[model samples]
Target: MPNDFLSPADQAAAEQQQRLLAAQVVRHDQLPTTIRTVAGVDVAYAQHSDQLVAAAVLLDAATLEIRHTAVVRLGAAFPYIPGLFSFRELPPIQQALAQLPEAPDLVICDGQGLAHPRRFGLACHLGVATGLPTIGCAKTRLVGSYHALGHPRGSTAELVLDGEVVGQALRTQPGINPLFVSIGHRVSLATACHWVLRCAPTYRQPETTRAADHLVNQELHRLLAAALPPAPDGM
Candidate 1:
């Protein structure tokens, strides 16, 4: 992929980096007992273009009120590689997150972490780089298989891959689809799932993810509209 920010790496080299990073992923607890502030990170891509927008939304964990938000427009430096999506998305996300007024105690990623094919997903990548507790709260499974969970909220099933437990399929709302929750870094899998459910009281997706998604999409649309040429007056 054509990248302006990072150096090019072949598949073998990239997977090797994933393996090394996987070893550094901390699945144990490494955070404060109480999480007052939470953050969510997501990226939205412009159709058929490398242009993209990333957003970081920080919220009051108790009230789900948005506290701070940061958004940035930039081009991705890597292709949509299956296990290495962090390379394409994290640069802009990290930039936006760095601009936040206050760093959140915990970060929820709209992607995978330990549930990845390499066990090193965007959440892990960002947490390690930023030294923050992170959780991967994916809308869909990136990898792993799980037995069907109960239909009621708080129901959970183990997500296992390669005969190892990596994450959970959790029901956040009654009769709704389950979320794929996993340990990113500095947080245990159980804590990740607990936070995800706590942040998602009404909706299926956590407030952090919803807030960041809304911000990124709004920013991307504004940018696209601004890039449009003026319409001819005589038409």
Candidate 2:
């Protein structure tokens, strides 16, 4: 699929379609206090193509060991438009999740949640689609302003939206870049922070997300390697 194929009217229709999907997205209640399993999803793109390879890694919360992994390739129809990333990413993520042995207790995504303008980022998309508890642990803020967090592990500042506290900017490692943590669905901001920290053993990123990111890069490079290369004689 190419953007050139979408007329101005078609683009408008696509945006409207996304809005309709967002309206149907389900929001869950608070999550269970103890999360025995957690999964993370990340995506990588094939250079110069409207294609993305997404990876999902599920891990046991206690042992922090991966129990399952799945991958899917998506021909992105939705543009990389702000506030509508779920439209571009979630379809393939859902496919990847379907291949898992068992659904995870919770999910974490590398994007926003309620912090989004439409309040339906990648984590929310997956949460709604799977009816599972989920949290958004993004590497950067999307739609809110917040004060700088303290230079200590576990220090956090509130991510406020329209004068309401929506999430937190958490410092998982002292003096390192902080992460934006928000409740996707079936969880609270507090629980989101707790689980994210628990999953962050020795890095700024959670182990689950880090593992998923690794898988994305790994699988993407593997696919690239399997493709034909230029002839040595430059024929």
Candidate 3:
């Protein structure tokens, strides 16, 4: 994608190494109860460059079996802005999504959704762009506050926006940090939390998303190592 495609306001922030828009809501909905395939998306950055890498891995929602994987590498023009994370990450994510051989019944993004300040985060942006049902499953809270829930992994608390409930904070593993689950587009916060807990076997993060995070980071490190020249001073 070209930098010109990014909004002029967003582009101005990019040039200064700053970001605009903490968050905003784009869209959302509920997915089919009997979901077949779920895709996990994650991004990793190069050691010292504007290069951003994204990977999408599809898996059987029920069996937790991997089906297909896609990857994208692109120059990241957006800065490390807290609220405007989607703007920085969405381009690479879109590329990876486009390369997927098969469309997934659902997509889970490693970021925020309605849980964000602007209500639109990485997951929401991508969901709107692809017109796919997506869920934002973040390892930590992006905005808002929540009362602690039951100790069990399935316990949850509503995420409110302007006095209206928009998402949830779910405890995926008992005694572990809860995940901020929110509707991206075409999904519900309740169903988002339900699927997240169901997909997690024993970790705080769901298997699919955890695996995707690892995969992208691995590729990132691999590329960085490849770019390094062998020791030339001696050996």
Candidate 4:
């Protein structure tokens, strides 16, 4: 069966879809005090093509050990558009998540959350769909501003959008790039940043993202290899 939601027929339909999902997106403090499991979602695109690979990595939050990993390769069902990236990537991502053995307690997404212009990023979409505690931990600035934060492991600055604080620029590690943390669904900004820091005891990026990126790269390599045509017999 085809995923109709992925490919919006027109701009009006895409806007309407975002409005509908935005209505369902929850932004609050509904987080678990003790996180036993955590998952991260990421996507990689093939060069000059719509082909994409989405990967999900589950980990034991307490020990940061691998629990399960799932990956899916497919041509992106939707076109790429700013502020509507979820539509392009969520199909494969959802497929990968469905392949997971079990759902994780928390989902850490590699994109914006409530910080988006529409307040509905990939994390928000995924969270509403799965009804899981999800947080967006983006690596770059999407739409926000902040003062220079201190060069400390725990320092943070507010990420403002539309004259309101939508996320936080958190320094999980000293002297490295900070992460943009925001509420996705069923989670608060404070709790999200806290978990992000805990998940990044060593590196700047959280363990969940690191693990997911590694797995996604592995899957991407396998997919590219499979897609490559056979060499000539003379070789």
Point to the candidate with the largest TM-score: 1
The TM-score between candidate 1 and the true structure equals: 0.94
State which candidate, 2 or 4, has the greater TM-score.
4
- Model 1 lowest lDDT segment of ten: 1-10
> Between the candidate structures 2 and 3, which one is better when assessed by lDDT?
2
Question: Candidate 2: minimum summed lDDT over ten consecutive residues — where?
Answer: 1-10
Query: How do the residues 17-112 of candidate 1 rate in per-residue lDDT, one tens digit apiece?
Result: 778768888899999888899998999987777987999999998899998989998887788878878888888888899999988899999999
Give the candidates in order of lDDT, highest first.
1, 4, 2, 3
Each candidate's number of clashing pairs is: 0, 0, 14, 0
Q: Taking the tens digit of each residue's C-alpha lDDT, what string does model 4 give over 172-225?
A: 989988899999999989989988999999998999999889888888888777
Ranking of candidates on TM-score, top first? 1, 4, 2, 3
* lDDT score for residue 63 of model 3: 92
Q: lDDT value for candidate 3?
A: 0.78
TM-score of each: 0.94, 0.87, 0.87, 0.93
The segments of candidate 4 whose C-alpha lies over 4 angstroms from its true place after superposition are: 231-235
Candidate 4 lDDT at 86 equals: 89
lDDT of 4: 0.88
